[model samples]
Target: MTPPVASLWRRLLDWWPRIARILTLAVSIVVVVLLVKLGRGIDWREVFLAARGISGPTLWAAGALALSGYAAYSGIDYLARRFLNHAQTIWKTLAIAAASYAFNVNFGVLLGSVGVRLRLYRTLGLRHAATAGVVLFGSVTNWLGYCWMGGIFFFGAVPRTLAAWGIRPEATRAAGAVLLLVACAYMFLCATAARRRWTFRGHPLAFPSVWMALAQSGLAVVSWNIVALILYLLLERQVSYPDVLGITLLSSVAALVAHVPGGLGVTEVVFVDALSGQLGAHEVLGAVLMYRVLYQWVPLCVALPGYLAVELRARHASCGAGGHDLPEEPYER
Candidate 1:
């Protein structure tokens, strides 16, 4: 090859990953724009009115469900600890889980969530590698649940859902089959090779036992259902539970794939598009707004104070110990 041609080819190879990332980001932005335009005709006044009309009983029910959902989220940490055979206290696990999730749900996962978890777990005397294992285990737990429940719902209820969106039944069934296959493959791996470990970046990681994997998947499904119930309650019980579950599952996948902060614009777009038939645009928007406030904002508010307290105690302990290092702040990264 000529020198210039060889140089150009090497440059293209070097830049390929970055180019692909840029293209993905551009596409995500366009999707958000189109979805926003689709819902632009919604009446803000009606949305506010719908929000205000939610009864006290309904609000209470939603709040209770939110609590249950978060409790299940905390259980993810417990399950991770059990899988690792770590002896951390229940209070510590719950505290770290709650605070980390509160941050992650609003911010993107890698952007903030894992950092918060690492900091808190370190404060509780977990080493860096062990902390990473916990984070990995928790993440795997979430995806396992997503795949298992998502596969079931997509195969059963969501084909009808796609039909509403004008998608062909055959295509929808194929997608569901793919999801189920992936879930089954993971379960098979756990059953056959649970004791195998892999190393990444100098850290060794092991898969959970078959029973533990099933437990993790089950906890994740229960958590997801509770969250969906919260949304259904916020929507004043107008939409059926199965529809809400399917929509929520698809919306979450969209948000994750889009890589948007908190899946902010992406989630709104998916929700409006999916639920527009059962509820008016304004009503759907209102329910989403309420769900965000109750499910995301409120938990974050409660968690921040707890985080602050942890930091203050760590600082105080560090000062008294004369030369001890303190846990890094969540914003350091």
Candidate 2:
């Protein structure tokens, strides 16, 4: 209210974004350091042996599910392309999406998902801001689903491991209530916000329709469930799906917050702790190892070549590199 205080407040507002990034980077460094220390405490030989104990059939099944999960991920971008009315073929959209997601999981967002998508989408005719819009849409859509699923599961069936951390069911349920409220608010905005748009830096993105919002949430929830199912199957269903799903979702938070690639060691540590009551450390680590192979590495291996090939083809094709391939409507400012 005072002029001096208001000036100070304005300066703080201007500096907040930088302050947040620095804080986030510091936190990620701490998390990664802790993860490294925790990782050293494990007996990797036992983890490897436990992986060897897995049956071939289960491995094959997990592989199949991984494919399905990746396909669903690509579907997110397909929705984005449609939302943007971008004139691109389905196969190309899928290729870019799949490759970007694969990178995103294996690398961090900037290095993998966002970077890969921006590069390939540019080759496919999207401008920088247009690609940013697509990336923003994909990001928002995923989190909406996460909120929906997290709120439902946390409220309905608190993770068994929460008790270990002295976290009360009531607390998680309260958190779930909050998450659900956020999801509902997004839905309400989609329905009534009337062509609302968000701008960060110079890139502006429009909100999807209510139906598209629901579709995004539905697809994302399924994709996330399939991820949990992969781990469950690898563990031979020894752990309850809700418990497994709860841990899986929680791990995503750690990785996302820390900006770790594919969550790397973060996921293994979280799973081991959450399921310690039901399984040995080795068993959990083994399932996680198999999960990394099937879900992350294999996709990365395939995607790398696919990405190079797409880039090569795009370079040879008669089109402006990094220029719009199609006439895109102006985004609402």
Candidate 3:
């Protein structure tokens, strides 16, 4: 590439994250202001009563689902740690992941997964290379499951909610099929190319074992579906599970791509837009609020103190810039 062109590309890459964050923050603020204006007409008493009317058994089910989903979320990092061959204890790794994930759910990746995980992992003596590996692997693991699950949902059942938007079911099914193909391709490559090294732009590519790849996809699907079931139960099963799961998968991708902190305003908007066909806007918002309380707010309340300890440890860091605890060739095959 030409010098000017290459420099422009480099600059764009550098500035992209900052630009995305600013745009996401602005969108979130706009959504909040709109909600506040609309809140004037909302019947809080009714909403509260509706939530209160839920059976105790259903509430217990939601709590169990939340805990299970969280455990599965932490398992993504567990696999990453194992993949990196880090010596951190399983409990320590899960704790860090759980805390960071809580922050990620409420805050953005910058503060939660990227920032919090970076600080906590460093204090445990991991170097930059190993830390990056964990982050990358965790991401890959989550996406692998999302694609397959999304594909299945899209192909197996057309979302009645999306039909209101004039989207063709056939088109949705085709897109889902594509996702399935991509998912299958990844597994095929892993099974055929494990331990093989291929380099791009001077950095080597690594593939985990097929079993590890399967584990990643399975864990992610489990985490995502449990969360969806929680929302479904919150909505009193007004919508079909397939419809809810499909929308949930789409929202997960949107939240990640938009980098909307905690997905604060983003998730509600998406849920209302798609789910309003089956449930009233007030009902949709109510269910989302309940979901937020369980999935984001409660965990965030706990993660705050845990992250505080992480900050304290960061002040007296035990980590090294040099690959001290890392293997000589740290990108494990």
Pick the TM-score winner. 1
Q: Which stretches of candidate 1 lie over 4 Å from their true place?
A: 1-23, 35-39, 194-205, 326-333
Backbone clashes in model 2, listed as residue pairs = 125-325
- Runs in model 3 lying further than 4 Å from the true structure: 1-41, 313-333
Going through the candidates in the order shown, the clash numbers are: 0, 1, 1
**Tens digit of lDDT per residue, candidate 3, span 158-225?**
78776876889999899889989988988987887755666667987777878989999999999889
Residue 141 lDDT in candidate 3: 83
| TM-score of each candidate structure, all chains considered together | 0.85, 0.85, 0.82
Q: Over the stretch 1-333, how does candidate 2's per-residue lDDT look in tens digits?
A: 699998998899999989878867976776667668667778989989999999999999999999999999899999987888776677888888889988988898887768899988877766677687788888888889899999998878777687786799899999899989999988998886465666655865357789999999988898999999999999989998888888998889878776677888889878887887889889999999999999989889999998898777776664654543554434432
Task: Give the TM-score (vs. native) of candidate 1.
Answer: 0.85
lDDT of each: 0.78, 0.85, 0.80
Q: Indicate whether candidate 2 or candidate 3 has the larger TM-score.
A: 2
List candidate 2 stretches off by more than 4 Å: 1-37, 195-205, 314-333
lDDT score, candidate 1, position 215: 89
Candidate 2 global CA lDDT score? 0.85
Number of the candidate with higher TM-score, 1 or 3: 1
lDDT measured at residue 163 in model 2 versus the true structure, 0 to 100 = 74
